[model samples]
Each structure stands twice: as structure tokens, then as C-alpha cells.
Target: MTDRQWADWHRPQQHYLIEPRYLAGGGDIRHATEFLRASGWKDRSKTGGPLVFHNPDKLVRVVFDPLAQPGGWTVEGRATADRPSWEARFGTGTPVEIIAGLTDALTQQPTAHAPNVWAPLGTHGWEARRGQHVTAVSPDKSAFVQFHQSSPGQAHWWIGARTEHGRAWDAHLSPTTPLSLVQALTTALSDPRPVMRPLGNVPPSDRIRSTSVSVTPAQLGAWQQARLTAARTAMWARSAWTAARPRNRHPATAAPRVPAGHTTGRR
Candidate 1:
């Protein structure tokens, strides 16, 4: 291992290795082996390309790969022996203490963020708003998510995500979604990947057939004015066109209308 990789390996915190780090090919494997031995993590495999470290309980497994470059050391553990396993990766030479800390944390139940679950929206650069319910827009303003206290089909809190590009997806979720997961999802939303959602309630055609629009007196007056203006414009255009055209000696007869309250002059 190089001086920098060795320095990274002895660090106090695990933050540096959360993402992949490239390690030079030579001597890293021996360095990792010696470090794993000092940390009391046993080599699970007698023969292997990657060194696997396991605690006495075997609940946590940390894999150190000298060749894992372009990828970091991976730590896998379960909340309990019966619980599902979760994995995280670190850079080339992550400190053993940091990996152990993460392994311990993974074995515990997730912390729930409730009631004030949406409070972190602002921290992620999302603008919070109140419409029929509550909503928040992403930092870049490319996407938005709304939380409804209650809606026609849903009685509990449901949220929807939408983008300016006509992509819309929503889900019904309890307020207990883990704060960490929520943060991760919001971060992912900034990427180009689309969020998937299920179809929501659709009204039957019969119900839509009964729907009607109501127009007020003001609207009626506006409609009448628009029709009158169009009629006058059309009349003027016709007259102008006729005057510009050649006229014949014979005149055509036209019908005349009587006034509303008066008879025609010739009955």
C-alpha cells in the first residue's frame, strides 16, 4: 500500500471510504491482511482472492479487496441473524474502527422520522408549500413531491412526485418512512433515473358522463360580446371583398327583417 492508502487506513472516521477509491496494485493485499489481523476479524476463507473478515458472531462480514479498486472494501451485516442483510462499500483503505461502527449500526433497527417527517425538506433545498395539503420542490426545481393529509380515495398520508417533463408518480406511505431512506430518495431524484409509481384511482365513464360545467351571468355576457364582434368583423370583410370585385348590372334581391316591436312596412 502507498503512504496515502496507509494513512487512510488508520483514519478515525469512516467517511472517506463511503465511496470507491482506487488503490495501486502492489503490496495493498499484504497491508490489508495485516490490518485485518490486528483488528481481531478472522479470515473466513482459507483460499480466496478477496480477504473476508468476520466477527466472532459471524453476523458481520467485511470484505477487503486489493483488486476491488474502482470499487472499495464492502461491509455486509444484518440487524439480527434472522433479519435481512444490508451492505455498504468504502474506499480502498478504510479504518477498521469505522467499518466496525457501520457494521454495528446496520444490525440495529432503523430510526423512524414521524409527525415532522417532512421537516427536512428545506434542508435538501426543497421549498415547502401548502395547497390542498403540503408540497415541496427540489433544490434544482426540476421535481416536486406533495403530501396529502387526506384525499378522496386515501385516508392517510400519501405523497406524489412530479417533474416539469410530465413524469408523475405517487405512493401511499405512512409517516414512519425512515428519515435516512427519505433523504436517499430525494438525492436520487436529482439524477436522470425516473421514479416509478402505481396507477391511482380512475373514475368510471358513467360518472364522467354526469359531469357538467356551469357558466355564470358574466360568462354569458362575455360569450355574447365575442359572437357580436365576430359577426361585425365578418360583415366588414365581406363588404370590402365585394367592393373590390367587378360588379354586374343586374342587382340581386335580399330579404328584409321587421323590427321586434314593429310590423314590416308592407305587412
Candidate 2:
């Protein structure tokens, strides 16, 4: 391992769950690892294809900056122009500047991790509004805003916090945070720069994180085989269960238990 990698190895971290699709372009593990490696971050886990990066001791936090807004998402200009206004009015400053200043605090890695990988914020013909949910005119729009993979389906920025960097102790949980505010904005025309979220609930900063690990051939095969076996076993069991039952009987009618509330015919 390189010096930078060693440094990153010693740091503390939070956990996050990232979508495979989000990690496709800029958010991918290879790209994030390259960036993390130059600055002393290391991939600690054995599971590959994840966005997990570890630091020596909370020395640095990898922030996921989405340069472009996905379809349906909006970025307020005046609010977003400088640093996000929340940092200013709220007195922190924009994430860009925050990360920039923190850069001097630790070793800044030089790799191809760019915001361009994340699609830039866009209005997509809808009027951009500040602090409000964007109006989705079409129920099934081709252009999908930022999507985060959840248990059942692909969700919006609210699910972005899943990409956390940390240990594999908890299976897939960690104590991490977001480097930038990649939240949803109003879909109206006259939006503000702050790009304040208007929804009642928002994805918390502590949620977004990266936890990348190196994968091995044997492990991958084992995992695949396990899943396949489980699936095949379940299918076979289901087939057997159904086949063993009477074909003509109604499924709702279970086998009768001993008769109750009956009087013997003979006295």
C-alpha cells in the first residue's frame, strides 16, 4: 500500500449504502478508490463493487459532489451560486468551500473523481422552485432525477445517504456524512439559489457515505452460488409443497381438525 493509502487506512468512518447504478459513472468504486488512494484512503472491506473507503482516523471525509442535476431535480442559482447559502446564512458556507478548506487539513488525492460524473442539476422545462418538490408532469417520465437504490425500488435524493464509508461489522451500516447538499429543489421557474429543500422530510447529511472494499474471485463465486442455491431450493420447495396437496381442493380450506361442538349420535 502507498503512504496515502496507509494514512487513509487508519482513519475513522461512517457507513452508507450506495446504488449500483449511481456508482456507474463518477460515483463508481474504481473512480472513488482512485481519488481516495491519492489522498491516503484505502479500500478496507472484502466486498467489491461498493463505494466504501476508509481513512486512518477521521482524517478526511470523502464527499460525493454531484455536478449535474438529474432530470426533475433543480438547483437555485443565487442560492447555489456561491457556496450553498445555508452554510452562509446558517454560517457554515457552501460544501465546495468547506471541502476546499478541509483539503489543507489532510492529503488531497489527485484522481479522476469529478462532479461531471453526477449529472448536473437541471430544471428540465419545469419551473424551478426553491424549497419545494418538483412537479412530475408525467407519471412515467423518461428522465429520472437522481435515484438511490432502496430495498423495494429506486428512490430520489432522500435515499442518497446510503453511501457511507466505514467498517463491515454491521453488515452495511456506518457513521458517515455527505460532502455536499445534493437535495431536491422546487420545480417552479423562479427558484432561489440556496436550493433549499421544501419537503417535510429530507435525507440527513449523516446518511450519505462511502464504504468501498476489495472483492475476491472466490468470494464472488461463493456469494453467487449461495444466492443461486437458495433461490433454487425455494423454487423446488414451493413446487413440491403445491404438488403434494389435493389438486381440486380450495387453497383457503385447510385440513379439518378434530370435530368440535358435535354430540355423539348414540346415547
Candidate 2 local lDDT, 162-250, one digit each (tens): 22442111011111111222211112111212211112212233432333444443444465466445444544564566578632210
lDDT of 1: 0.39
Report the poorest 10 consecutive residues by lDDT, candidate 1: 16-25
Write down the TM-score of every candidate: 0.26, 0.23
State the RMSD for candidate 2: 25.0
C-alpha lDDT of all candidate models, in order: 0.39, 0.27
lDDT of 1 by residue, 106-195 (tens): 222333432133444455445665555555655544345454556564422333333333323333333333333333333333333221
Q: Which candidate is the best by lDDT?
A: 1
Counting clashing residue pairs in each candidate, in order, gives: 3, 51
